[model samples]
Target: MPQFALEPAVIEPMVEALGFELVDLRVAGSAARRVVRVRIDLPGGGRPGHGVTTDDCRRVSRELESRLEAAGAVATQWELEVSSPGIERPVRFASHWRRYVGREVRLKAVGVRGKARATIVAVPDDAHVALEMEGAVVTIALEAIQDATLVVDWSTYGKREAGES
Candidate 1:
């Protein structure tokens, strides 16, 4: 790990070693004060009623701090944040597509007019994903996707009996 250069390669293994998946990683600010925000979740990120906890975040933070300190990676003041990926999390990998099959997503694709809501239907290979959009199934190469995020449907969540705001 080079000084002030924290790549995914340096963090991914540590995150995985703690039984969590690295959802996203962002580094910001100058060497004087750097902020490293890490989003983590249970592997597959689809386990019902299971999620990364605060204790999990604490452990990951401690581990990352220790590792960075041991390697003299960051000589200046730094912050390490670990937390769960929020709703509408970005979907970028074949594993994400596979894990989210049957779930709708808001997708932006190259050559497409605008973002559209589509349900992930299949992942035929590592490089392609099939989506059901507008009553038709479309297979798209992963490279064609400009961006994509899982759609959070709140209609069925915590519904009151009747006439409730």
Candidate 2:
């Protein structure tokens, strides 16, 4: 079976069982030197604000290493890099939108209403994301979003507005 086919069938479940979400998996390099890069994220509430940790990566790496060895998934020596999804992480799937709901995001759509930067208000379903742009709420279909990610603006969150206490 192809590497792509093997990933969803065998690797994903194994990774998920270790309390990690498999973000992406890909096999690179020539036949002689194959590198299987598995990108993973911590389960919800893993950190104070849903961020991944180094310990989480270590745990996932250890578990995946043992499981892959027992299953004989890789014949040759391969490198494994288990790390957190850093700042500017790509929002590739619906789960991302759902996870990052209520946060400000920068999105670029393909052939829709051009690029937009807005706060994700809600994810009603897998098909669409409700956003607030310049105080105007809009629902953008998931298919229309070409790229997106949460934008952390500490200044906005830290400042005091012009109102009575």
Candidate 3:
């Protein structure tokens, strides 16, 4: 595996200092040009309407970009994109699963053919989760899950217009 220019260890603290959770981070490319994609979220896990805003991304981007440039961490000309985790943001860590209990999520497990939309009922332990799927509650090892993301129902947010579903 090729080493990335920016490591999580360095970026995590910088992001947290800005009072946001570092949801995800990825750096790609060579010494000449690099692509840094950062996903951020509120410490409280912002939901739908009350989520991280454009200003937040800009704040992070500016600070992070400046710091990296001053430190000469990567190429001087690097692309830094800071944005919020979308409505269907990934729920990969135990803390994330715990944070979203009672919320619906789409899960892709080891033997599942397709992604299953289910409510995260509980986090029994660090290694397992209890999800309510298809009217039945099932306990699944965390390792069995390949992917899990929040399921957002936009209609649940604000008032819908007349004749809307």
Candidate 4:
């Protein structure tokens, strides 16, 4: 794999210091048009319309851009995009999974009978996640999970709109 200009070690601390979590960093496009896509979120977890905003992205972009320049991470011309991990944000890290305790998540994990949807009941130590499925708690190792995404509660919009009208 080719080395990226902006490694997580180089950008994580700078992002965390600004009170945000570095969800992911990817360098795409060709060498001529490098696109550095940085996905950010709140430190713990932000849900129900409380996630990172445009202002947050803008602030991080300006600060991170400056830091990257100082660190010589971006030597060539590139487009830096700082954005939030949308509603269906991918849950990868154990810490990220822990933050969504009591929230629903759709997981495509190994050893499971197709995709599973469950609410996170508990997050014990040692790379295991306890999920509530059919009123029962099922513990699964984090390594078994291939992909996981939070299920958006669209009903919340209905309640919020009803109160305003």
lDDT against the true structure, per candidate, is 0.85, 0.72, 0.84, 0.83
lDDT of 2 at 162: 57
lDDT of 4 by residue, 25-133 (tens): 7788887778998889997766556889999999999998888877677656689999998878878777778877889999888887788899998889859999987
Error of 4 at 9 (Å): 4.3
Writing each residue's lDDT as its tens digit, candidate 1 over 1-165 gives 456888768788888898888887788888689999988888878443467788988999999899889989887798888888877787876888998899999999986679999999999999999999999999999989988988987774334557555
Q: What TM-score does each of the candidates earn?
A: 0.71, 0.60, 0.71, 0.68
Those runs of model 1 whose alpha carbons end farther than 4 Å from true positions after fitting are 1-9, 28-34, 46-49, 72-78, 144-146, 157-165
Residue 64, model 1: Cα distance from true site in angstroms? 1.7
TM-score of candidate 4 to 2 decimals: 0.68
After aligning candidate 2 to the native by TM-score, how far in Å is the CA of 130 from where it should be? 2.2
Clash tally, candidates in order: 0, 0, 0, 0
lDDT (0-100) at residue 13 of candidate 2?
A: 91
Worst 10 residues of 1 by lDDT: 156-165
Sorting all predicted structures by lDDT, with the top scorer first, yields: 1, 3, 4, 2
lDDT tens per residue, model 2, 6-61:
46457779988987877656677766667776767776523335677778888888
